[model samples]
Target: MKAGYLGPKATFTDIAVQNAFPDAERIGYTTIPDCFKAVINNEVDMAVVPFENALEGSVHLTTDYLFHETNPPIRAEIIVPIQQHLMVHPMQYNKWNEVERILSHPHALAQCHKFLHNQFRGVTLEQLTSTAAAAKYVSEHPESNIAAIANELAAEKYNLKIVKENIHDYDFNHTRFIVLAHSHTEILPSLTSTYEKTTIMVTLPSDRAGALHQVLSAFAWRRINLSKIESRPLKTGLGHYFFMIDINQSIEDQLVKNAIEEIESLGCHVKILGSYFSYHTQK
Candidate 1:
């Protein structure tokens, strides 16, 4: 089997893929869309991409792409702990404090905002495409006074020295990555299944009063537990939007099936993104 992920190498998405599908042949792409495209184009059997972060909320790019572009079914989910570190090229290890700029993906930079403000006040912070990309840049430019905020795997992969470990502000930092494929894909036996989840996209009928409330009521009255409900713009207009709802039940469940039927009867559009098991890497 082949797996595609967002990376040059050693990004958080890559780490999740590594932990969940170690035996599969891994291919790295530069962007989340690239990973999705790879799966759509049959470049790989499946693609793993970051979905949400504990601290950073949802990855909008990933969600938007899934809603608008790729539309692949999520086969499984992998939750991996995140530990962002401040790393510098080995050549600048001694002068790490004197580094002029810190580079990382925008999300990583935001995760370490408190640390950056407290430690490196006024230092230039630049957003790269990915954390691993920043690490790669620092590694390639040995003479530059730059540091990168990335994971330990990235530091190891790029041969950089981690000047400060666990630089992210919070300890409960974990990211949810989803496995996308055209059909069913076997999950690793080593992972521990946390729960079953069924994610669906809902578009409420326009100009209908209480349409949103009615949609929620369909699941609420069914006694279905919703894990998450978030709204994303449909991009057609300012008021046009759709809701992404995650239920803590599988689509195979009779109650969940009834709830979807109830919702659709109200003139709302529904799309089942996936019904799959969510797993966490064994500690």
Candidate 2:
């Protein structure tokens, strides 16, 4: 089997793929949308992309694409611990403080905001498509005085030297990545999960006074446990939005099925994104 992920390699998504699908062939794409397209186009058996981060909240690009673009069933979820480090080309190991710029993915830069503000106050912070991309750039241009904020694997893969470790502001840093594939595709046996989850997208009826409250009530009365509930703009117009909810029960459960029916009866539309197992990986 072949797996696609957001990468040039060694990005967090890549690491999740490596841990979960160790024996499968790995293909790297430059962006999250590219990974999704690869799966939709049958370029890969499945695609793994980051969904949300503990410190950074949800990845808007991933969520937006899943809602507006093609609908691929989430096959599995992987949770991985995150550790952001400051690294530079070996040539500038000792002169890291005098670096002209710091580069990383926007989320990574934000995660280490306090560290950067306190240490490199005036340094230029540039955003790249992925953290690994920044490390690759610094590696290729050893003569330049630029540092990258990325993971330890990126530092080793790009042959960069670590100037500082664990630069992220929060210690409880973890990212959730989801695998997208058709229902017929069978995931490799190497992947194991700790629990199960079911995610659904809901669109409430407009102009209804208690439409949102009624939607929640459907699940609430059924005694269904909701893990998360977040709103995203439908992008049609002002005040038009949809909710993405994660339920702790599987779609196969009778209570969950009944709750969906109750919700739909109230003139709301619901889309089941997936019902799959979730895996947790240690650092």
Candidate 3:
């Protein structure tokens, strides 16, 4: 599998992707959008992008792409626990007295919000696109008194030190990621099963009360068990939005696909977010 993940390597997403497909060919993109595009354009076999983060919350970009991309299908899903750490340059530890700012992805900053406010107190915070990028930035700008919050691997890869370990607010915090593929291959079946999942996003027809009820009813009436359903503003028009849902089944299951088709035909758009993996259990 040509797996694409958010990277400079050592980011939480990269670690999760690596854990899920250990031997799969890895392709790192700077942003989740690029990973989505890679899977859509056939540049990669599967692209891993985070759907939601336990502490930091949903990865809006990844979820938004699945709702709007309209091209490549999400073929699989994985929920990997994220262990966030505070990493800084090895040489900067002694200069902690000189450090005045911290850097990390927005979500990363959010996750460590309380800790930062309590510990660092008045240090200025800067945002980077991803934790990996933040690690790289501090590494390259060694003279700057900026440390980054990232994963252990990122610290190692970028030659940083862990000022604090397991800094996340919740130890069980996890991030779920969806795998994207343009087309399923012969070897894919071996990777898919009922234990896997199928994700779909749909928009309700109108603000009418039963719009969402009917759409979900299609699955419930068929006895299809759903794992998740979250709604987001459509962002294109006023007072309109779409929903992202996941079911514990395979896309090949006729009932699941038909239900999806039924929703689309009802004057609402439907998107297949992918059907892959059960929970990416951390061992």
Write down the lDDT of every candidate, Cα atoms only.
0.90, 0.92, 0.77
Off-target runs (Cα >4 Å) in candidate 2 are 189-191
How many clashing residue pairs appear in each of the predictions shown? 0, 0, 7
| Candidate topping TM-score | 2
> TM-score of predicted model 1?
0.97
lDDT, candidate 2, equals 0.92
lDDT of 3 by residue, 79-104 (tens): 77777788777768887645788888
Q: Per-residue lDDT of 238-274 in model 1, one digit per residue for the tens?
A: 9888999999999999989999998898889898899
Quote the positional error of residue 177 for candidate 2 in Å. Answer: 0.2
Per-residue lDDT for 262 in model 2?
87
lDDT of 1: 0.90
Off by over 4 Å in 1: 184-189
TM-score of each: 0.97, 0.97, 0.88
Best by lDDT: 2
